[model samples]
Target: ELKVEQNPLFLSMQEGKNYTIYCNYSTTSDRLYWYRQDPGKSLESLFVLLSNGAVKQEGRLMASLDTKARLSTLHITAAVHDLSATYFCAVDQETSGSRLTFGEGTQLTVNP
Candidate 1:
């Protein structure tokens, strides 16, 4: 069974600060993804990590994956109020085609 977990289930961050959300999984996976969601809205894809050491960044959000450890991270740089939202990491099992198991998610509130 594959299980995904994320730390800091709830985060309160001030604007202009940096933070990192950690994601860990129990099983081996080659693909990992990061997503963001706003209140009452669907998730938005932030990054797709396809292999070990794969990294992607956009604006204030950066994501990386390490398949060997079955771990991934989402790093926030200079977080702003607009970046406040819920973040999630999903892992794709090698045997499961297009099936992604999502983490509990980290709800971040960026205050001024």
Candidate 2:
């Protein structure tokens, strides 16, 4: 079985500060994804790490994957209030038949 775990389930930080969210999986995975969800809205795809050592960045968020270590990281740089949201990391297991295992999600709050 594959399981994903994310640290700092809840986070509070001031605007302009930086933080990193970590995701660790129990098994090896070639694909990993980062997603963002607002209070009541659906999840929005932020980054996709398709291979080992893959990294992706957009705006103030960056994501990276290391298949060998079975870990992925989401880094937030100079966080803003608008960037406050629940972030989740998902891992794709080939044996799962298109099912992706998701982490519990990290709720981030940015205060000015």
The RMSD of every model to the true structure, in order and in angstroms, is 0.9, 1.0
> Model 1, residue 80: displacement in angstroms?
0.3
Worst 10 residues of 2 by lDDT: 91-100
lDDT of 2: 0.93
lDDT score at residue 51, model 1, on the 0-100 scale: 88
Q: Report the Cα lDDT for residue 102, model 1.
A: 96
Residue lDDT tens for model 2, 1-112: 8989999899999999999999999997878989999999999999889998898989999899889889899999999999989999999888657778999999999999
Q: What is the lDDT of residue 62 in candidate 1?
A: 88
Query: lDDT at 23 for candidate 2?
Result: 98
Candidate 2 residue spans exceeding 4 A from truth: none
Candidate 1 matches the true fold with a TM-score of 0.96
Question: Over the stretch 1-112, how does candidate 1's per-residue lDDT look in tens digits?
Answer: 8999999899999999999999999998878989899999999988989889998989988898888888899999998999989999998886746899999999999999
